[model samples]
Target: MTNHFPLTAKRSLELLGLIAIFGVLYIAKDIIMPVLMAFFISIMLLPIYRFLRKKKVPESLSIILPIILVALFIALIVWFFSNQIGILVKDFPQIKSNVSQHINNLSDWISRITHYNDKEQKAFIQGKSDDLMNMGTKLAGGAALTLSGVFVFIGLLPIYIYLMLFYKDILLRFIFMWFKTDHHPKVKDAIYETESIIKSYLIGLLIQITYMTILLGGILMIIGIKHALLIGVIFAILNLIPYVGALIGNIIGVLLTLTSSQELWPVITVLGVIALVQFLDNNILMPRIVGSKVKINALFAILGVFIGGSVAGVSGMFLALPIIAVLKIIFDRTEMFKQWGVLLGDERPAKSPMGFASFRKKKPVAVKSGTEKEE
Candidate 1:
């Protein structure tokens, strides 16, 4: 007779395995993050790479060309930001005056609402400012270390991308070799699906960023909001962080508006514009562009973002969805982990397990005359 481990044992083993995986990821994040990022970028660039190859371009040249194009694109963005920021910096005195005016306004409002007078509010602000100054000092001390790490990440990224593309076949073979011959088809399907999903998602994000910047910045500029382009760029980038990002973008938009202008209407206008753009982007743009192939429910998506941030900071947070999507693809293909794939998806059932109909599919809860208990 054959014997199997109990369900409890299986669950414990799975839990332990997950803990071990995340532990390793956190410990070796510096080494893993760049490679992971490169892998995704390479996947996104695969079509370009293949097209070059089909045109009889040298493999080395094809790889290098894509990397160079990406570098140029990044440099262009950096230049634009620097130029815009220099203009913003030139208006610092005006911004400071506006900020002070806003602070006085706030103090007056607070004094009217509470018992705190202007002196008390100023004292409180001074104390907090000192605390911030000290915190800034500490951050300045660590800035060099952070800067060096960023350099290292950037330096290693292209090399990793190039090598991954060069050795793509070997990687495929390695993956296929791990599974039995019978499972190769499933593995290939998963690989192809992951590639499709990653490519679509990343490209869609680029498109979304472009339009968001244009829509937000253009509207704000049309309304004569100062630093409109800067606000648009900041929000467009931050909006990549999923649900949490849009909220942060709104806060940032309002703060930028307030800092640059002494008018309350601009602040309100900024908020309204941000809200409208976000609504349109979320409802109309993202769905059609990114598609519903990898539908992660909100609960798990938020948890993934938090867990990823804990494990690998901002890069982790940004990568959370695609990583989860890849995992979901794998899990859905595997019999043992198919339930997990379902858990990660956004599909709604017709009814709940306790007999409550799904909101999406409401049904009349008819009661039998005698046999069925209302309880």
Candidate 2:
């Protein structure tokens, strides 16, 4: 009994330590989130950084080159969205008319289906107008805060990336120093696997974004949907965040369709198209591209997304999967945490059905126990 006491105490302490770590993560999210983002970004940019270094580019220039390219890519997306917004503004009058017509159509349907007349509906909405106004004011304030945070996050991100890149060797040495000389090989293997998985996942996502945007935007354009390209690009990017982002994308696509079209069919069409795209992405595309690389179960992925969002908003949600993957790698390599790695892993496989004929053939025959023993 005494032999087990120390082991139990150790595990209890470990649990409390883990709880403390998460608490600190939640409390210090403002700083930690940006650093984590930079870490992941640096990992993704490592190949490019190495390529440039191989060409004998200066260290600082190699680091700066990828950041500049990323910045330009972001700027291009912003320019595209700004252009789309301008088009939306130009067509606002028509949109307003269509919305008004839709509202009237809705009211007529309501009157036909229920006892609530148009006057009662108007009165009901009028009563909530002040509440809606207050909600809008709160939303605007939140938006301002979010915008400021985004700018600060963006500013810190590149500097953090550069510093991480600059100290890569030191960091590698520090990691090695944590373990004994005999364990270096295992540590190196873990690091190599972690890097490979993250690289594959990130590259897969980039390809997903490109192909999804083209497929969705092209289809919508063929079907005569306005702002089809914008919706496609927006949804494709948002869908990268997993479950929550896809829901938000659906809402945005439907709202855009509603505002732009007088007929109800386009809204339904947009919803259907988004659903089909999501199905294809999840079952066919993701398996082929990401394909058991991260090996995260659907349950943990969804929970991580929600928990991460609660802790650190959008960045947290976006970082959740890769971070979990990295953690699993570390855990699987460590003797103490291999059980946790197993718990986090996707280990299930399809089972074949039982064959009745085989079972019948293998069935035991009845015999007298004494006679069989004598024989």
Candidate 3:
């Protein structure tokens, strides 16, 4: 026989309180995202801060130098890309003409294959042509909006970064102080794990991005792709979104190649290069760097990316994996959260092979047979 008890009123109230908290967070997401971004960026740069301090750099200078360098690097990229974009804008009429030609060619090909009349094909393509033009306009507008936001975020970022760096110690202490005395060990362990995960993830990501940029840029240039630098930079930036990013980059490259040149070889070359880079990233770079650091499975990673994209757009997608990693770290360190941690991690909770071996050795089993009476 089994007995069961209903949840007490206090337990029900606690569950409702949690739901209320989540509802509030959902509503206040916009305000929260910027602050969360600041915190993550600060965490990523903390190692540089420590390195500078170790070299006897002043606290203020240590904090300021990394932030300044990062800001300048971002500024240079923006400036270079802005000039390239200006050229593209100036050549927009030619691009549109090229696109229209491509569309016509595609329609003609479709007509031949399907045995449709030229007039019907033309009518169908006209609708598609309008859609393409509208989409191009929207993309350009979105890019402008994104760039404007970047500048604003950059201008405000240093202040938040500095504050985090300056008060890092106080912040840690404050967080730990929330727990009771008996829980200090657990809290400290959680903090340590969180730091390890964040540091590993950020550094690994930066290295991977740089590697991809150089590899992709060289390949594009070798394939005689126009605006190779721009394409490379775009791919590298988008590649931060994990699984879907490389696919998007490849699609964009193929479309651009197809539109600009009628040469099938160039398009094939572009596709090949992207595939090779993706292979290398997945087999070599990602496994050695990111995989070791973040133990999240592909399913959770994809879910995180989608949820993050919904909440915070591309920036949210970039933040998603690290956020999940941090949460996994915290959950792993908490007794009540072990199940969540196990769900988040890729590894099974089964005992290690060595442990089983040792246990077997310690408690060896006796074999019995009809002819083994001497034993």
> Which candidate wins on lDDT?
1
**Comparing candidate 1 with candidate 2, which one achieves the higher lDDT?**
1
Of 2 and 3, the candidate ahead on TM-score is 2
* Candidate 1 collision pairs: none
Best candidate (score: TM-score): 1
- lDDT by residue for model 2 (1-375), tens: 999999799789879998997899899999999999888888889999999999999999999999998789878998999999999999999999988888889889999999999999888877798789999998998898889989999999889999999999999999999999999999999999998999889889889999889988888889999899988999999988978889998899988998999998988888888888888988898889988889887889999899899999888898899999999999888877776675677753122114234322222223233223422
Ranked candidates, highest TM-score first: 1, 2, 3
Give me candidate 3's TM-score against the actual structure: 0.83
Q: What range of 10 consecutive residues in model 2 has the weakest lDDT sum? A: 358-367
How would you encode candidate 3's per-residue C-alpha lDDT over 1-375 as one tens digit per residue? 123233355447756875785566468766667677888889888888989999999999999999888888788887988998897888778777777777678877887889888898877768998999999998998898878876776667788889988998899889988889999988888787778778778878788878888998888887678767777777787888878787798787777666667556777887788788888988888788866778787889999898778767777788889988888887777665555666687763234435556423322233333244431
Candidate 1, 150-221: lDDT as tens digits? 899989999999999999999999999999999999999999999999999998999999999999999999
Name the regions of candidate 1 deviating beyond 4 angstroms.
Answer: 1-4, 354-375
Cα RMSD to native, each candidate?
5.4, 8.6, 7.6
Q: For model 1, give the 10-residue run with minimal summed lDDT.
A: 359-368
Answer with 1 or 2, whichever has the higher TM-score.
1
Residue 138 in candidate 2, Cα distance off native in Å: 2.1
